[model samples]
Target chain A: MTAILKMKGLGFSYGSRVVLNGLSLAVEEGEMMGLVGANGAGKTTLLRLVSGVLKPREGRVELAGVDLPGLRPRDRARLVAVVPQSPSAPQGFTALELVLMGRNPHLGLLQWEGPRDLEACRRAMELTLTWDLASRPLSSLSGGERQRVFIARALAQEGRLLLLDEPTAHLDIGYQPAILDMIEEIRKETRITVLAAMHDLTLAAQYCHRIAILHEGAIYALGKPGDVLTPENVSAAFGASVHIGEHPVYHTPVVLPLGRRGDDG
Target chain B: MGLARNRRPPREAVHPSPGARLLSLPYLSSHLAVALLALVVIVIVAGGIGSVYIPPLDMLKIVADKAPLLSLEHTWPESWDTIIWQIRFPRVILAVLVGGALAISGATYQGLFRNPIADPYLIGVASGAGLGATLLLVTELPIYSHGLSLLPIAAFAGGLLAVSIAYSIARQSGGLPLTTLILAGVAISSLASAAISLLIIRSDPDVRPVLAWLLGGFGGTQWRDVQIVLPYLVPGVVIMIAYSRILNLFQVDEDEARQLGVNVERTKLILIGAASLTTAAAVSVSGLIGFVGLIAPHAVRLIWRHDHRVLLPLSMMVGAGFLVLSDLVARTIVSPSELPVGVVTAFCGGPFFLYLLRRRGRVTL
Candidate 1:
């Protein structure tokens, strides 16, 4: 399959500190690529670069063969949608209002949302099981509810590529798989590409078709979950010795971290 | 788990289309009608009352006579015509225009900065205008001609220059940080205030007129003053109202707005520029009125939804009506000796502001 998102020699820095250096990755059409990395390992920065929120210091990002930096924001948004980690939802806006904003990328500056736009928003909300919270203020929703609402918004954008930063970071155990499953269903239905930064290695292994392990500021390993998420790779990248086992049903890798020196509580 | 178990039936599913409930035409029209009626009543009643109290019927007749199509009998004395048409009429209209301009600009500022305390004058317009007016007064420029004064022109230039300076200082890496913007504004405002004080101290002993102007009043207003301000105020206000939808997007952080296809930096600059124009125009004509900008938007938010499409226009009306009523009190409460309209707004706005803080407990920007 052709790559929907291509990052060539991506480099970024925060003042003097380099976060991503010569980082290259590609997400193929209609595939879910999981990004696994240790804390401060530039996962969020990579997603930001892909979403065109931050300009790369060097190299380029291409969305469907077009240079992302050269495109206007509205045009770029039409090709890519992003769900940031723990996005701050402004108070007094209803869940429906927030979701309808997803249509903004598609609408003109002076255009209000029409019937088709509202229909798409409603469908996205229903798919995420957030239609009941449509009239509720964002401030009133729980963290999980807010995350689902944001995910619904990204879905409403109808972009060819979706970028999510720690989408399940704040979800409960019950919701973690549910939200991921909803994304998987959406990908199947729409044939869209997804690049999600996942902290849960086992969950990533279960949901993502392929996994890329990031260490420091480079890709440590990239391939199928079984090939990339080996015990040695997880230990080396995360500084945690982990026992890797297979899932009983799906037969995918399941990571269990071992306790470090002298800490048994 | 609890969320799924206690799920309420989807309200959106019941409606044929989404946003129908929130965008109900009947609800919006009813509220609009009530506000429009209140505004009309206040304009008529306030026009009737002054140092010389003309009855509401006589005020209506005076207005009717002025209308080209309506040839009403001129039973009322000719002085009533001058008072109602030439003097009081223009003053009331000025109050409405200035008040509407200030309030809508305030709403725009608050939405752009995402801060409840952000007022139109937050970025040095008041002090800069004051300094400009004071300079013109002290120098005694012979530029006043045909009911047009050079003071307002100087004030407008000063206000725009001050805001531009603050904007440039606060902008970094093509982003405007709110804290930095506020700090820059405060610094510039203090510097302008110092200049105004110095000018006042060095000027001749006859500074009462300048002092009174600084205090802010609708006194001595004529059709000419209204005409002078309309060119700036009307366009600035229209631009702000046009961008109300974009302003709603700004309530979120800049990155979020940009991701939603809003040109965040460009929109911010345009909004700030438009708001500054309105503020400078209003202040130049009426001399530094306080609280209308800050209070009117807050009042509208308390009653109506925070959607800027509705909030902007409603706040304008509220501001216009509020100042008209306040000007009425300023002229009559003491009777024969008028108070500056700004003093009354502050007196009323202060308590209302405090009440808001106490009631809400915490501010949501």
Candidate 2:
């Protein structure tokens, strides 16, 4: 399969602090990959770079094998869909309007949302089970509902590659499974590639086809979740020792962190 | 075309849920109808009201009779014709255009900065124009060459220059940070204000006229002044109206705007440029008219929802009507001598502004 998104030596920095250094990653067509990293680990920064929201200091991000920075906005958008953690929706926007925005990449100059765009938006919202609340303001929705609305927007983009930064960051447990399950189902239905940064290791391990653990802005481990979600790697990345056990139902690796001195609660 | 065709098959075959369908639809036709009604009302009331207080029927007849070219001149008394044609009509037209321009530009600025407080004059545009006009006054330049129209051009140039500087500085990176723009605007505005002060204080004489200009006035606008403003004002208004669709997208999120193939930076530059031109032209002709640009859009948003499609045009009509009504009062309130149009607008605008502040509660920097 052709690589839809390819990053070469991607590096970013703020002031003197280097966030991503010579980070090389590739997302091929129809792959669902989860990016697991601790706080401040540059996962969000990587997403921003791929989305062309931030210019890379050193390195290149290519879409459909073409160089990213040089491609026109329309072309880049046609190739990639991004859910930036939680993007701001200004006042007066409904769940439907927000979703319709995903179709913007496909629109022509002077062409806004036509019936076709609306249809795509409708499909995305329906797929996410958020069609019922389409007319409602985004602010009125719960965290889970808002997250699904954003995902629907991404689905509407019709892009080959999807990049999400901590999509379930602030959601409750019930919401986390429901939202992530919807994403898993959408991937199966559409064959759209997804790269989501997940804070919850067990959830990431369960939903994602493959896991890539990012430690201090570099890929620490890359493989199946069973191989990558070891107590040693988790401890090294988070500075806390933890016990890893298979989830009873899902059979995914679940981490239970001990105290800083390695004592159980 | 290829992309559109490619998208049609899967999208149509795959039915979207009814809930999603409701969200994506654009209600332009209905919005356009409502906006048109509001505009008609604004025009009629604006033309009809003044100290002379012409009735709507007579006002219509007076207007129909005097409209040039087609010459629909209704058979009205000469005094009424003079009142409608020469005085109230022209002033009302100017007020509508100027108010519309300022408020539209204000809407543009607010979207550009993503802040409610961000008016078109947020960057030193207003102060820069004030400074330029003040300089022209203190220097006692050959006014016979250009007449009053020179002030608007000078102000336009100053406003354009200041905003360009602020925009460039704020967008050091490819993106413009909202906080940076606000800070830069404040910094530039203060600089312009200080320069205007120095010119006022150090001038040999003519300081009072300069002060009056700073306070804003629309005392003696003639057809000549209207002609001077039309070239910039008309094109500027058209550009702003055209950009309203993009402004709607921009208000959502810059990244979202960019993804939809919007060249966010370029779109923003065009908007800011157009807004600055309108403001400079409006300020030049009318003097330093305050609050209409800020108040009109906010009022529209409060009454209606915050959709730029409606907000931009309504704000324009509201602004124009507002200034015209205020200008009418400015003339009739004291009669004979007449108050400066700016003073009346400020009086009205000041209270509205306070009400907004009180209602919204205080926003800390």
Candidate 3:
């Protein structure tokens, strides 16, 4: 399969502080790619670069043989859907209203949403199991419910590339798997590419086709979950001691943390 | 990105209807209709009641007579026509336009800043305009020439300057923090208000007219005043309405808004400029009317959804009707002499504003 997203020597800096440097990778058209990193490991910064929200300071990205950052903001948005971590849920707005804003890229200047736009949103909400929360105010929803709503919004964007930053961070045990399974099902059906920044390595190992571990402004390891999620690699990336096991049903990696690497224990 | 791709639905399928799309919605239509009808009735009531007391039926006939090819036999007294047409209509129209201008501008600011409590008055926009108008009035510069009024121009420039200063001062490394923005606005407002006081004190004319204007009312408003405000108000309102959809995106996270195709900085500048212009135009005529902007948008948001496509128009309607009715009470409640319309608005609006603050405690940006 051909790579749909190509990043060549990408680098970024927030003023004098470099966040990600000399990052290069290719994402195939339809695979689910998990980005596993600890806090400040530059996962969010890299995702922002790929989504064209933050321009790369060193190199460039190309999506579908076109320069990503060179494209207009609306054109880039039409190609990428993002579920930002900890997005502010406007209290006065309802869940459906927030979800409908996903259609912003496709809409023309001054255009209101039509019946078809609403239909697209409804389909996304149904898939995410958030249709029931449509009329509820965002302020009243629990964190998990709001997280699902945000996911639904990303789904409603209907872009080819989906970038999710902590998509299931606030979700419970039941919802975590259910939402991941839904995303997997959709990706299989529609061939949409997913690049998700995940804090939980075990969850990443389960759903993602390939896992990339980012450490110190670069990818330390990138391979299939079985190859990349070994104990040494995980310990090195996160700087924490961890025992690696296998899932009973899926046979993917399951990481059991042994606490901080240099703690008293 | 591919010539052979078939991903998004065809553009025509998702295209919004060409005209008045919000009014045609099944759920919102009835409410919009009611608001619209209420505005019509309020206009008539506001226009009809004065010292002379022209009836609504006669007012309608007089208005119709002015229309070409609509010659109705005049059965009313001659002076009644002058009272209805010359004196009353202009004042009522001024009230409507100014109120609508303030409400829509307020909605624009509230959306752009993502602060529910934001308004023209709260952000020091009105004080700036008030200062501008005070400067013009005190200087006795020729305000009207070439069928345009320089008063709104001066006010618009001054208001825009003040808001830009406030916005820049409020800017942090991350973004515009709302608390800082409010603090800056308050600081700017006092400075401008102090400047106005100095100007009036130094000029030392009959301070009564300036004081009357400062307190805010529509007394002695001429047709020329309405003519002056339109050049700024109409375009300002149009720009805000056009930007309403984009403004909703601002309520979302700014980065997400950018990823969703909004030019965040550009949109911010445009909406701020438009809102300030509208506020300046309204203030130039109505002089420091407070809280109609705040209360009207709040009422619409409370009763209806917070979608700005719906919010903007409904707020304008509510504000127009509310101010016309307020003007009615201001002029007639005491009879002969009038209370400032701003006083009436503040009487109701002050508690409502307080209640909102107490409930929300801190409005997050």
Best by lDDT: 1
- Give interface RMSD, per candidate: 3.2, 8.5, 9.6
TM-score, B chain, candidate 3? 0.84
Would you list the clashing residue pairs of candidate 1?
none
Off by over 4 Å in 1: A262-265, B2-30, B140-147
RMSD of each: 2.5, 5.2, 5.9
Residue B266 lDDT in candidate 1: 82
Lowest-scoring 10 consecutive residues by lDDT in candidate 3 chain B? B14-23
**Model 1 lDDT per residue over A96-184, tens place:** 88888888888876666777887888788777778778888899998888998998888889888888898888888987887787788
Q: TM-score of each candidate?
A: 0.94, 0.89, 0.89
Residue pairs in collision within model 3: none
TM-score of chain B of each: 0.93, 0.84, 0.84
C-alpha lDDT of all candidate models, in order: 0.86, 0.77, 0.83
Q: How would you encode candidate 2's per-residue C-alpha lDDT over B14-123 as one tens digit per residue?
A: 44434444322246556556765766566666666665666777776665655576565455566777766676666667777788888889988887777787776787
Task: Report the lDDT tens digits of candidate 2 across residue range A76-151.
Answer: 7887788867677677677887787788778664556778777787778777777767878887987777888888
Query: Clash number for model 2?
Result: 3
Off-target runs (Cα >4 Å) in candidate 2 are A261-265, B1-58, B66-74, B77-83, B146-149, B204-206, B358-365
Candidate 3, residue B69: Cα displacement in angstroms equals 1.8
Worst 10-residue stretch by lDDT in candidate 2 chain B? Answer: B1-10
Q: Is candidate 1 or candidate 2 better by DockQ?
A: 1
Arranged by DockQ with the best first, the candidates are 1, 3, 2
